[model samples]
Target: MSQSQKKIHYAWVVLIGLIVMVGAAKGGIMTTGGLFLTSITEDLGIGMGSLTLYFSIASIVTMISLPIAGKLIAKYNIRMLLVVAVILEAGSFAMFGFMNSVWGWYLFAIPMAMGSVIVTQLAGPVLINNWFKKHRGLAMGIMVAAGGLLGAFLQPAAGNLIASEGWRNTYFILGLGVMAVVIPVVLLTIRMTPQQKGLQPYGMDEVKHNETIQVEKTANSGVTVAIAKKSSAFYFLIIFFLFDTSIAAFNQHVAPYAVGLGYDIKFAGNAMGSWSVGVVIGALFFGFLSDKIGVKNTAISAMFTGLVPVGILIIEPENPVMFVIATGLYGFVVASLGTLGPLLTTALFGNKEFSRIYGLAIMGLAVAGIVAIPTYGYMFEITGSYTNVLYAIFIMLIMNVGAILLAFKGKKKLEKAGLWN
Candidate 1:
């Protein structure tokens, strides 16, 4: 290795920025969302179903935006994109402070989803893929773990803020606060690729310098977007995405569920915070596990672990101690959405068409949001309980195991057909 190449890689710097940026955007905004659900509905005289429908609306926008976001990220300067993205996202979030009508969330959902598509969903995985060729799973886990760590602190804080300051003021403060923090971080640290820094991706130096091997690597691994789109592996991955998102969507109702059980907002906040802590530990564990055991096995294990929490919720929803423990365990399993999702994609399709295939694949996530978020809310509204939703989530969590197996089975077929070659 050259002496210069041995110097500290800038990819770590990019990752630091990503940890903060995505953390604040997701942990600061998205994870804190449940804290506001009941407060918004009660204050505005809206039903839970009607109010949570805005989340579905936002998901619809996210669904439409993912492909466009993929292209924009490819075409535009990332720093500039992130600056505008955070502004739109946090700005729209703050704008909610002024709305007495549901239309405010509905209208802002467009810009909010657009901005989040760039910030939370796309940037971390895409950039990590560009920068870290080794320990990529670890990198993805750290990014998601940042959100968990930050959200752990933010959730209870937000809950207390809602109690003292009201949801409106809380919204304004969080939005502006995240914007002030995330925008500058983006400009200082993020880059689209390692090439922009005149460096090879981390660990690229380890590859053997043989022409035939390089050619074979490309030939065997370079699954184009067009070919990926036609492959059964791709479709099965999408199905897994859908079921996974559906399972995770139950989190949006955690606070509301607690409230319905007569727990105060502060308790709900603390419970969600516990969930965040679970996320931190879970993300790191799964990432490391994927590296050690493999993505397929780790995913199946996660699905099984996830069932424990769902069962606890079903059997002991009103038990405060059990509720917190269950939700925290559930949060750990949900880390799969961020960690395993991208890892599984790279495992099945390689990185040749990663952005496009992943872009299309995560649309399942948005679609689940559209379908599952308000559906859970309506389940509560209609039944006067969350019992039915819990059952549905349990079923979906088990179904995810099947989906994971099917996805890998399809990938094996693709490899056998020489599509991967």
Candidate 2:
């Protein structure tokens, strides 16, 4: 019996594996890293500016690595690469438990960022693109939402652990623990492509049956990498990546933001938990909405929708309930970075050399994080409030609306030039 003809497609198996590995990497390590800010700074007597500066270091490394990582993921053996990535990410994270100086963070930040660049940033999107012929948006959403699901559980638990077990111990336990679980799952489930299982992508049959869609030709169609790189769509994608990532980078500061507002760690933990819940729901929403309403409209609506949370944060952040609500809403906006980033990439550039194009374009994330994360930290440290930061985020959201429209305009130019097929 052919795999695609079975009751379940193998792509679902690939997706399930991604959900576990990416979820663990994102939820257990990446998102949860922010939960340690307050405790680590206070306990170690490190300045907020100094510790968060490590994020800048990490971002720089990620930026430099992304293009190379793109080529490597396309060319390398999937299982080998993923295993090493998890170890680099999780191992570096666990080693944080032993650091006594800020330089330790700076040092480990290198490998950690390298690992996460593959594990957290690139893997799910690349794999889903490879494995799904249709419903790509939904698969991306579900994988991202699963990260949220793990985050919804892990964030609070890590918070409580920090309270009970100390930051060092919590770091070791979470890092090693998630690594332990994720490595085996990656080995068992992830494949570079569906062709490995002697099966076509999920929904390939349906795509072929639909006359207008033109399955094989459509799959082969798209601008070459050189053409895409020179196009206006590429530039707007960089802007979109920058602003969207800048919005999401606020996650690293959310806990500290709450504490600075006079909320305790417990409240901050729950707030992170709320953000995770929003991520799960919002991821699915963006995925479904992108497919139904189109990525451009959905991206525009997301920017406007983001303003509500920023407004609430600016106006009434002191209210405990409202603050958590704002964080949750913020999470919804952040989910777009995961669910919509790749979708937008495909929409603008088509899927040709998607790895390289998407990799190069989303370096804006690295650029944004390097500037934004430490900027947010230093802003709070200097002003003793996130007021300006929230206002800044508001502006970024507005700018992105313009960026999205212009990006599509750029796409039209490519089509007019006879590059895009």
lDDT against the true structure, each candidate: 0.90, 0.91
Which residue pairs show collisions in model 1? none
Tens digits of per-residue lDDT, candidate 1, 350-401, equal 8888888899999999999999999999989999899989888888888888
Model 1: residue 385 alpha-carbon error in angstroms:
1.0
lDDT of 2 by residue, 135-247 (tens): 99999999899889999999999999999999999999999998889999999999998889987888886553656466787885788889998988899999999999998
Candidate 2: segments with Cα more than 4 A from true spot: 1-6, 208-213
Least accurate stretch of 10 residues (summed lDDT) in model 2? 205-214
Model 2's lDDT to the true fold?
0.91
Which whole-number lDDT from 0 to 100 does residue 36 have in model 2? Answer: 92
Model 1 stretches with alpha carbons more than 4 Å out: 2-6, 208-220
Rate residue 188 of model 2 by lDDT. 95
